[model samples]
Target: MTKNFDRLLEQSLDELSVQYKTLYHDSDIEGMKPLAHVDCTVLKIHGDYRDTRFRNITDELSSYPESVNELLNRVFDEYGLIVSVWSANGIPLYAM
Candidate 1:
């Protein structure tokens, strides 16, 4: 990826908490809340828990970085709350 895209991706990940809050507000479930903290792998993958896999996040890290995504998926498999993105039903659509 280009330097610009890298920076954009970094910014996107850094702002995940904010983006999550906004999305969660509109689709907040009874028992679901945004994650208070995230891990290094999660941050690196740039997975926003508040983002829905089924929806389009025009202003966020809508997609995962390839090199990181696969590796992150393994981490997710082990413990799927690193960057846990939930659906309306509270199912984790993707956790990296």
Candidate 2:
């Protein structure tokens, strides 16, 4: 399962990177960066530019037991963009 998840994460990150790059390019934002932090990996889009930040929690999915899903759901509902889950590779797993 972990291996499958890792592959998924890698794919997701690649997709997200392309998407973000397009967004930034279209917006013509020179210094814009999309920062994402999952449990173990930190992925930064335009990391050198240091403009925007995105916090996601997909990394915690494996650690959190099924019982905590309710609590996690609540957090997602309440925080909106404050918390998210990303895959180990820092691809967004869930966004709120």
Candidate 3:
């Protein structure tokens, strides 16, 4: 990633309080740096509890934001998803 884009991603991750986006590196003195061990990106499709934002029963069939949609699309197309879904009515669906 470009340096500028890296900073931007870090800023956005911080704004969302995403704990996985960064780590306190022993080699780095400037504080937390982007996680470099793996190319893992965590998507909050179910929303975040820190800000008390979550998807409800009604939201089960609702569309996600464009950005989320794009990521979801790209992830399914590229990295693949291992999902365990809870139905709107609270039924447990097997992971795929």
Q: Pick the candidate with the highest TM-score.
A: 3
At residue 35, candidate 1 shows an lDDT of 39
Where does the lowest 10-residue lDDT sum fall in candidate 1? Answer: 21-30
Off by over 4 Å in 3: 1-19, 22-38, 57-61, 85-93
Tens-digit lDDT track for model 2 on 2-76? 212123444665866633232211123334342232222322322222233221345632454343344335434
Q: What's the TM-score of each model vs. the native?
A: 0.25, 0.20, 0.44
Full-model lDDT for every candidate: 0.39, 0.36, 0.46
Candidate 2's displacement at residue 91, Å, is 22
Cα lDDT tens digits, model 3, 1-96, are 111112444566578776543221212213423334435454445543343344545755276566556545765776776665556697987657
15-67 per-residue lDDT for model 1 (tens digits): 77434222122123223342343333223233233443322356544654464
TM-score computed on alpha carbons, candidate 3: 0.44
Worst 10 residues of 2 by lDDT: 20-29
Segments of candidate 1 deviating more than 4 angstroms: 1-44, 47-60, 82-96
Model 1, CA-based lDDT: 0.39
Two-way TM-score contest, 1 vs 3, winner: 3
- lDDT score at residue 94, model 3, on the 0-100 scale: 69
